[model samples]
Target chain A: MISILKNWVRGSNKLERFWLLSKIEYKLRYYENKLGLVWALIKPLSEIFIYYIAFEVIMKAGIPHFVSYLFIALVLWNFFVESSLGTIQILATKKYLYEYTNMNKIEIYLSVIGSNLIGLFFNILMFFVYYIFIEKGMYVSWHIIFLIPIVLNLVILSLGFSLILSNLYIIAKDIQQIWLIIIGLGFWISPILYKLDTFRAALPGLEYINPISNIIINARNVVLYNHVPEWGLLFWGLIYSVFFLLIGLYLLNRLGSKAAEKL
Target chain B: MELNKEKVAVIARNISKTFYISEDSYNTVKKRLFNLFNTPKPKEVAALKMMNFQIDRGECFGLIGRNGSGKSTLARVLAGVYPTDTGYVKINGSTMLMNLGVGMSHELTARENIYVSGSVLGLKIKEIDKVFDKIVDFAELREFIDTKIKFFSSGMIARLGFSIAVNAGAEIMFLDEILTVGDIKFQEKAIKVFEKSWIDGKTVILVSHSMDVIKKYCQRVAYLKNGVLEYLGDAETAVNMYIAENK
Candidate 1:
C-alpha cells in the first residue's frame, strides 16, 4: 500500500504523459480533415437522426422525449463500442510507445480510452444542449450528478474490454472480426432505440445479463424520465464492468509479454 | 577491478527467450475449428540462449554480431522491452532504445514528436519546453519543425530522433544503429556528441556493426553468434573475433 502511494507520487509524470499523448491522438484523428472536430458532433447526430426517423416517425413508439431517450443511450453505447473496438489492435499499432521507451503498459491503454473519452465528453455536452434548447425535456434535476459515476463506469468497462481484446489480438487476428459481429449484434440487443422496459419484458433477463441494458435504463431514467436511477441495476452494472476489467487486466499481464516480439 | 553492487547498472542471469511461430497461422474461429483435430506444431526459434552478463554504471558497452545473432534481442531483453523466457534481467535506472527512431509517429509534426518522445522519456512539459529548441536546432530541422515527419526524409527523421535522445535521453540508453543513418555531417556531429558530452557518465549499450566505433567507445564488448555469447572481453579481441568470423 505504501509502495502504491510512493508510485502515485512518482507517477505524476506518467499521468502528464498520458494526458499529452491522448490529446495528440485526439487531434491526429481529424488533423487532415477540413471539417475537423465538427465531425465528432456530425457522426453521432446523423446516427441519432436516422434512428429518430426509423423508430419515432415510422414505428411510432409514442414514448415521450424519444429523442432525448435515444440520445443518452447512443452516446453511452457509442463510447463503449468506439473505445473497446478501437483498442483491439492497440498492441500492434501502439507498439512503438512501449517497445522503445520505458512506458508503463497501462498508460498505452489509458491513452486510447482517453482519446475516445474526449469524443464522449463532446457528445455528452451536445446531448445537454439538445435536452435544454431543442428537445426541451422538463426533466433536468439534481440527479444529473449521477452522470459522473455512470460515465466512469462506461470508461472502466471499455478499458477492461480493450485490454482483453488487444492482448488477445496478438494471438489471433480473427478476434477483431469476431468482436465486430458481437458488437453489431450487441447494439440491437442493448435497448438503444427501444425502451428498456420493453426490452426487459421481452427478454426477461436482459437487465441482469446485459450491463449496457442496465446502464441505458438507468441513464434514461435519471436524464430523460426525471426519476431516481434503478440502484440495484446500477450496482449490478458496476459489478459486471469491474469484473470484466479485472479479467482483462489479468489476461494482459499474462499474454502481453509477447507483444513487442510478436507484433 | 572489484565488481560490487554499487558499480553495476545492469545484470542478466541465465536469460533465454524462445518464440513459437505457427507454420500456418490460424487466428479465426472457422480456421481453428477446421484444424482442431489436426493442429500443426509451432516452430520454435530461440532468440537468445542462456546468457549472463553485467554492465557497470557509467560504462559504455558494445554488442556486436551478424544479422540474427541475437544482439538486438539481448539489447531488448536488457532494456526490459521483451521478457526473458527462462531467467531475469535487472536494470538500475530507466532505459530508452533507439533504432532508426522507432517511436516517432509519422502522422505528427517534428515538434510534436519531440514532446511525445520527451514525455515518454519522463521529462516534464516544462523540461521539454526548455530543450525543445535544442532538439530542433541540433537536428537542423528548424524549418520543418511543424511539418509532418512523414514528409521528412529518412535521414532527417533519424537526425530528429537522435537529437531527441541526446537532449531528453534516459539514464541508460540502448542505441541500435542510431548513428548509421543521416548524412555525413550529421554522423560527424553525432560522433562528436558521443565523444565530448554524451557518454561522460551515462550507461550506453551500443549495438553496431562498425568495428571502429566498438573499438573506440566501448571499454568492454560482448560478441554474440547465433544466440550464443561467444566473447565478452576487451573491445580489440571481440572486434578481431567478429572480423575473422565474417570471412
Candidate 2:
C-alpha cells in the first residue's frame, strides 16, 4: 500500500513533466500551419459534419434529435480516439528522447495525452458556442457542469490505454497495425454514433461493459438533453477507468525500461 | 539531502543484455505454411555479457571501446534506460546525458526547450530558471533565444544541449560522446565546464573515442571489450591498452 502511494506521487510528478513536453508538441504541430490553432476546431468540426451526414441524413437512422446527439457524441468520442491513437506511437517516435534523458517513460505517454487534451478542450468549448449562442435555439442548463467529471474520466481511460499500447508496441511492432483495426472495431462496438438504448435491448450486458458508451451517453445527456447523467452508470465508468489505469500502469512500470533495449 | 562523499555513487554487478535478431518471421501466409514442413531457422545476438563496475563519488571515470563493443549498452544500463536481464544497478544520484539534443523538439523555441530538457534531466523549472541566463550565455545563442531551435545550426543545438545539461546539477553525470559537438573554441569551453564540475565533487562518467579527452580529464578509466570489462585502472594505461589492442 505504501509503495502504491509512492507510485501515485511519482506518477503525479511525471504528469508535470508531460505538461512541459506538451508545450513543445503544440509548438511543433502548428509551426507549419498558418491558420495556427484554428485548425483544431476546423478538423473536428469537419469530422462531425461528415459523420452527421452519413448516419443521420443518408443512412436515415430516424433516431430522435439526431443532429444534437451526433454533435455531442462526436466531440467527446474524438477526444478518446485521438488521444489513444496518438499515444500508440508516443514511445516509438520519441526513441531518441527516451534513450538520452532521465525522464520517466510515463511522462512521454502522458505528454501525447496532454497535447490532445488541449485540442479536445478547444473542440468542447466550441460545441457550447455553436449550440447555445450561435444557434440561439438550444437550451443551456447547469447540468452541463457534468462535463468536467466526464472529461476527467475520459483522460483516465486514455492514459490507461496509452500505458498498455506504448509498452506493448515496443515488444511487438505488429501491434500498431493491429491497433488500427481494433480501434475501428471498437467504434462499432461503442455507442459513439448509435444510442445505447438501441443496442441495450439486443446486446443486454455487453453495451454496459464498454465504458466509452457510458461516457459518450453521459456527455450527450448533459450537453444536448440538459439532463444530469445517471449516477449508477457514471459510478461504473469511474470504477472501470481506475481499474484499467491501475492495470495499465503496472504493466508499464514493469516493461517501460525494457523499451530502449528492445528498440 | 546530504550525500556521503566517500561512498560509492554507482554499483553495477554482472549486468547482461541479450537481444534477438529476428529474420523474416512474418513470411507470407502461404510461405509460413510451407515452412512448417522445413527446418526452422535460428537467428540471435547478445549485446552485453556479465559487465560489472563501481564508481566512488566525485570520480571522473572514462569508458573506451571500439564501435559495437557494448560501451553504449553499459551506458544505457547505468542510466536505467535499459533493464538488465541478470543484474541490478544501485545508483546514488545519476543523470544521463546519453545523446546531446535528443530531447529538444525542433519547433520549440530556445527558452521552451530549456525547461523541457531541464526537467527531463531531473531539474525543477524554478532551478532551471535561476540558471537560465548562464545556460544561454554558455550556449552563446542569446541573439536567437526566442527563435525555434530548428533554425539554429547543428553547433548551436549542441551548445544549447550541453549548456542545459551542465546546469542540471546532478551529483553523478554520464556523457556519451558529447564533446564531438561545435567548434574547437566551444569544445575548449565545454572542457572547462567539465573540469569545474569535477572540482565541485561531481562524478562524471565520460564515454568517448577521443584518447586525448579520456587521457586529459579522467583520473581512472575502464575499457569495455565486447560487453566485458577488460580493465579498470589508471587512465593513461587504459588508453594505451585500448590503442594497442585496436591497432
For candidate 2, what is the lDDT? Answer: 0.77
Using lDDT as the measure, the top candidate is: 1
Q: How well is each residue in A17-45 modelled by candidate 1, as lDDT tens digits?
A: 88998999899886569999998888888
Separately for all candidates shown, the number of backbone clashes (residues 3 or more apart, or on different chains) is: 0, 0
Inter-residue clash pairs, candidate 1: none
Error of 2 at A31 (Å): 5.5
The CAPRI category of model 2 is acceptable
TM-score attained by model 2: 0.85
Candidate number of the best TM-score: 1
Instruction: Please state the Cα-based DockQ of model 1 relative to the true two-chain complex.
Output: 0.66
DockQ of each: 0.66, 0.43
- Candidates in order have lDDT scores of 0.86, 0.77
Residue-by-residue lDDT tens digits, candidate 1, B67-108: 999999899999989888888888877799989885888888
